[model samples]
Target: MMSDVLKNCHHRWKTLNQRWSLQTRLLYINMLLVGLMALGISVAYYTLTRYDKKQQSRERLNIAFKIMQDDFQERL
Candidate 1:
């Protein structure tokens, strides 16, 4: 009787182990996806910020050039 009980217990343990391993794999896959998403978002944010700064710099440079042109014309 004891041997039969031990066999049943062993079988149950094997089933539980398989389920645990599957769950662990799924968790790892989910973590990887989340990491990728975070990286993509970070890159996009940086690009947008850089573009905005470039636009502002261009506007400032144009204004400065216009001022210089006007000043030179007045002197002439």
Candidate 2:
């Protein structure tokens, strides 16, 4: 099964290789690499921003809790 898959891929690659020129293949490869890099960067940025938001929310909650504790202590 694995050999069959490899044979199919080789056949498709040969067909595509014959259809496109060397320069066109290089350009296509470059565009694919750049697109992949952009996607990776965007994912990283999204993850970092989400983490920062969570940290900020936690900090705000802690501050509010401190204030409430102080108020309760003063009343008692």
Best by TM-score: 2
lDDT of 2 by residue, 3-73 (tens): 99999999999998899999998999999999999999999999999999999999999999999999999
Evaluated against the true structure, the overall lDDT of model 2 is 0.99
Q: Estimate candidate 1's alpha-carbon lDDT, on a 0 to 1 scale.
A: 0.96
**Regions more than 4 Å wrong, model 1:** 1-20
Give the lowest summed-lDDT range of ten residues in model 1.
16-25
List TM-scores for all candidates, in order: 0.68, 0.83
Off by over 4 Å in 2: 1-9
lDDT of 1 by residue, 1-76 (tens): 9999999999999887787877797898999999999999999999999999999999999999999999999999
> Against the true structure, whose lDDT is highest?
2
